[model samples]
Target: MNVYMKEQEIKTKLSAWVAGQSSGYHADSVPFDLRIIEQRIITSVQIMELILFLEHLRGEPINPMQIKPGAFSTINSIYQHFFIEGQAYA
Candidate 1:
């Protein structure tokens, strides 16, 4: 596959893994509007955790400074961090 396609695949896989991890903590009674708030918090935490996990998988140390603001604004952004930007886990 092309580099971009491969990156997209990685992003999708990472997003799914992150979502699955966060899903376990989700509340069933959260209203739809409040769901956005919950998701934002969870997404932020998940992104950080996912980065750590990726770093671990790649046998590297976590670099908190490298995680830019808005880096995890969207799932696509997280993918870009790893594949397009070559940030990997560390």
Candidate 2:
């Protein structure tokens, strides 16, 4: 698939997974609206969790090193990292 289509697909899957994780924590903590927390507070642990979850959903092995600073900074970044850089399941 083309990059745009691939990014969209990844976004959809990531949204679902994030929603699930959010619900697991609190009913009101929607993953998409994490704006309540300052961006500076977003730790590597959280990013790593997201990376592992996405990798699991794609039936691929998780690679923490692939999730670099610019890569896991945002949802879009995650998509770019895995699809464009890591090229997992591409």
Residue 62 Cα positional deviation in candidate 2, in Å, after optimal superposition:
3.0
Model 2 misplacement above 4 A? 1-3, 23-46, 87-90
| Clash count of each predicted structure | 0, 0
Query: What does candidate 1 score in Cα RMSD to the true structure?
Result: 6.1
Candidate 1, residue 77: how far the Cα is off, in Å:
0.9
> Each prediction's TM-score against the native?
0.57, 0.57
Compose the digit string of candidate 2's lDDT tens values, residues 1-90: 986787666777766655554434443233433431255434556666776677775667765654455655555666666766766433
Q: Assess candidate 1 and give its lDDT.
A: 0.55
RMSD of each: 6.1, 4.9
* Tens-digit lDDT track of model 1 for 8-87: 55655555555566554333322222333235645556656777766754456757677666555555665556545744
